[model samples]
Target: MRWILLAISLLPHSLFAEVADVDLNEVSEQQNAMKINKCCEDNELMVDSVCRLVEQYNQSAWIPKFKTEDGKDTKVKHYRFINGIPRCETTQQRPIFDLGKSEDQLNMLSDGRLLHLIHHKHSTEDIKEDLSNNIYSIHENIALPEEREPASYIYEQDKYCMDKILLSNSNITGVYALICVPEVKINWRDTDFILKKILNPLFHAIAMVLFLLEAIIYFVLPTLRDLAGNIITTISVCLIVSQAADLVRIFTEFSNHVSFMITDIILYISLLGAFFWLNSFGFYIWKTFKSRNVFLRVTDVRKYCYYSAVVWSTVIMMAALAICAHFLLDTGTNPNRKMRSHFSSSIIDNDIEQETIGWLGIAIFFTPIAFTIIFNVFFYVTTLKVIKRINIYGRIHYKLKGCFDLFLQLSLIMTIAWLFLLLSWLNFDGLIYAHIVVNLLQAILVFYVCVVRQSHVTFLLRKSCCYAEPVPTGEWGDEMTHMNGGNY
Candidate 1:
């Protein structure tokens, strides 16, 4: 409630900040009369102008352009002057805006036409007046007219040749504009604070409660026979770790910055927990089909494999941190002038180098990922195949194969969304939409799966059948042909 009230109190200023940005764009369009920079050749002056206009609106950081031959920062000084000049091969002349710089000497230049630049001294009072009068809402406040008298028209034409110029001075090139940064406004009611904080915990909480209930059933309810307890217990641990990581993420986002190493460690542990937990559930399935006499031995081996994955995942977590750090350090050291060339070159170079030296790193990140899709496809196909040949217990076992398959599938969907987001981060579009959808689906899926486990009997039956089969400890379930003995 306090957050909501605070946000409401800040709404006016936020609205004002938005209006201020719009005004800046308009002013920039008026001042920047021409566009043709060293960055782009063979492009029309208008194209360059429009690019600059949009870039300014989008708040693209200023990039330093150096003339290595001349040993000068060409971007700051002369680039703005020559930006609109056409190429030697082109006959097109770019229209230039006059800032009303000097009115006394309006004469033709050596190039055959004289152009005047307009300059305005803006004051805080003037800005406040404009805002109070709501000039931002008026369309014609800064818009150029379609028709004008000859000399007056020339003045207007010369005043603004480019689309818009918010600000210009001796030191500033092109359109340099200021944006009033808005105050942060977090609303509890409007911004979903409850959803954000409670959503992950709800999944974990349900998992925890179900796990406790299952544990109680193991001790109390004599006929509550089911492997669902163990499965739920494993899944509950994963969900708990996941929720812990989520909380850590929220803290990092909202609280004081912490070293990346701490974050990496936290993430590593969380992901390891999830990876191992899921694999453990898979091992449980392997144990389930083993012959009754060999059940204990197979279960032990399966347990070992699950623990191994957890340990390996932890090691891979450290490796992922190193790989990420390498990229960050490589990208962070260069100045603006070298950024474009450096990054483009690094992608080509690093792709080859990382492929070899970072092989484990890539596998750690990508294998479970590649296997996820493979596993899902195999699950769908094998499920269909087994559905045809299996008995009632077999079908039940198949259905309840993974303790938290629904949540795992949801996580897989989130992983797919995350992969696309990674691939497109360089030029991410609709990123917020992708983030919201993935998070919402994850929360919804997790909550649904955890809450629905209260009455599930499929896992219990599968456990019973897994312990009932008979075979040698090493050769357990080696032949499905023996499945016809009704041992399952």
Candidate 2:
């Protein structure tokens, strides 16, 4: 009897265990159902058991549709999409009884109502009480004409009219007419003008003046006619051309398309030339520093010719590639094209074509510049390592050290300016301002480094001014003697 009781207790334990497992499974299923339902919000719907946004939910559709009291179909003048939601405004049409009358009038009343009048044996008048607030609200404060002239009459007669209102006959019937009122103000201040017009052009002008002065000094002074000086002069000339073109593009309005294109090409070529010359400067410094013979002349006519050929050829080729890409490529749009078109008087009729060209132009222009800067950085690092070794051993002369230091400073300034320019294209906030400031200061920095602090330049200036006697066998003398020998 006791064994039977033990078996019965064991059976109850097994049954209770089975019941608990079923209860837990039921609880889990209920929890999963709750989670699935909770995953989607009110604005979302379930598709394939996954939550997704309702792409076409427009809250404006709930509002009552706009209609004219005359029951005529409203004509949609323009429509645009904002965040995937469609927004459009319609123009109301008023009919005239006679087609030959020159005095049929449409007027904007003091309270923003449009008054339409027909002249005949008995005059008929219709006043449109409700106007599109988005359109007519801009002229609410300004006093518009009591009689709105037809667009054709305004064009033929050249009469002064309100800025934004244009009246034209409807396509369906010559007697019926529609009035155009833009949804936005045309004369509002654009914030971008502050950068493009005021800041960039001013800095570019200042840089251009400094570059011009530097170029003049390099060319006129017989003391500065070495290979290094020639290279610096070329760089200055290129920058001058670029800055002049840029200033012209900003200040002058281009009425001719071909002229504008030519100016643009010239600007790109000159810009590329400036950067390529800078790279040439780095290459020359590297070659000079890496040479084993310390007595070897730094100036070589054949080598300068070679560098000039290479830099000019590369710049022209890159500019040609940019032109070809602008004509050929049909990829994604450029975001800044609209801004350019708005600021400049050049009207871009084809959006896709202009966008492709703009983007391609940017790519072609910046790719080579970026590579040039990178190569310059590599050359600078290698040369700095050599200079560091020489400094440790105390074998390098002070004049040679000063020359190298000048090259280093110029390279660093150019590299940093170009890097900031490249970063500005990423469209980060305030980076453009930083780029402008750095580039604006670049000309002054270059002048200070290459002219003011340069031992050779100061030595020549002092000798010319009778302020000090010329040193016979020093660093500047050695460089000048070698340079003159190579030139002759």
Candidate 3:
């Protein structure tokens, strides 16, 4: 209730420091004549006029020219102008707003340089485009200041061109003007926020809770802690930590200044965890089928710990290098001009060296990832072929069941999510939606396959629900085949 009240209290107040709610009598507010610096090619005369008619304007919109989509019009909510002229390049003329303003003469030379502030929301590589060429099609030449703070603002310095401008003010949503700086606002009531933060986190939380429940179950049955289970549990732990950090990041507005670094570190940890464990899972599946036994000799804790230390060390070193890239290359006044965490992905779009410090991080993080994917694919296919080969000596029914069990293992390890990610990398339009859904639900799907559906867990659940006494471990069915090897 207190959090709800606090959020409500914050809603009515636009968190913008001084621009939006500045006192009308203050210095910047008093100079209502919209101020902008404009320059052009050689022999360009001094621009001495201010558009006065803009003061009485009621409402407006900033239309943008999207270079990524040919002949299509796009809209931008805001723009930031560091120091640039809003001009029409094709006509070789300075932009003249239809609104009223005065032109005053001043001595100045034409300098063909301009700076443009862009969207507070960064665009994904597939959909992002430069719109400078289309700036002349719009009447307004100022960036619109945000009306309300948006939730989950992501502005990466992947490159921003001042050529495209979208301007807005306190009341009107300006068509195209560059703003100086903007703030992202997230509202509890916003539907988009509900979907991305509130509801999405619920899915992740459910997955985490289910993983914990399964961990508790596995703890009581000490024999269940085989290499496969160990890998599954570790992957669960990684997902839990990753999701928890994402929850913190999306919900807390101020966390980016402090807790965000931890989030960045954990992201890599989760990625590595998934890679190593998924490969191990494929191996466990293949080994079980070849040996025709559910139980494999477990490695000693010392060896397991040593292996973990090596993997964690590798992850930490790479993450630290990305951290160095973040600080070393991020040299600019623009807040967006910095390294971003999303660049940790293997996708080439994120390796925007010109706009972000992704070159170092991409090389270090994605190399092993590419190999992991290739090996996992190899293992998965080989496992299926081996299963089919083994089926040659088994009954028809048993052969079918074996193939089905392998299919379940594929689902548990999130084959679909990787497929979607690959599709997204290929730039298949409209697949990002599927990619997000499959990725977010991975933990839940894993829990369902690896735990809830397990014969022991189901038996235990039935006994508990029926108010029956607990069964002895000796009576547990086919203990050797916990999941992938369960049928044995």
Best by TM-score: 2
Q: What alpha-carbon RMSD in Å does predicted model 1 have with respect to the real structure?
A: 22.8
Candidate 2 stretches greater than 4 Å from native: 1-196, 252-260, 294-299, 331-357, 391-400, 423-429, 465-488
lDDT of 2 at 126: 18
- Candidate 2, RMSD to the unseen true structure: 25.0
Candidate 1, lDDT over the whole model: 0.37
In the range 1-488, model 2's lDDT, one tens digit per residue, is 99999999899899999999999987776554311012234454323223345453321111111123342434322221111111113311111212233334433222222334422231222122211211111111122345553331111011111111112222111122222222222222665556655777889989998898888876766756656778889988988887787566554322222234556777778878888888888787787678876556545567789899999888888888888877667333322122132232111110111121366686898788889878888987898887777743223344456656766787788778778866775545378677767878998998888778765576566555665544343425635544454221
TM-score against truth, every candidate? 0.37, 0.53, 0.49
**Could you give the candidate ranking by lDDT, starting with the highest?**
2, 3, 1
Residue-by-residue lDDT tens digits, candidate 1, 18-117: 9999999877875653332322222222222233433534433333232322223233332233233223221112223222221111222222122232
Worst 10 residues of 1 by lDDT: 334-343
- Comparing 1 and 3 on TM-score, the stronger one: 3
For every candidate, C-alpha RMSD to the true structure in Å: 22.8, 25.0, 18.8
| Candidate 3 structure quality by residue, lDDT tens digits, 124-216 | 321122223222222112233434232221112221112211232212122222211223344667654455556656766776787677666
Ranking by TM-score: 2, 3, 1
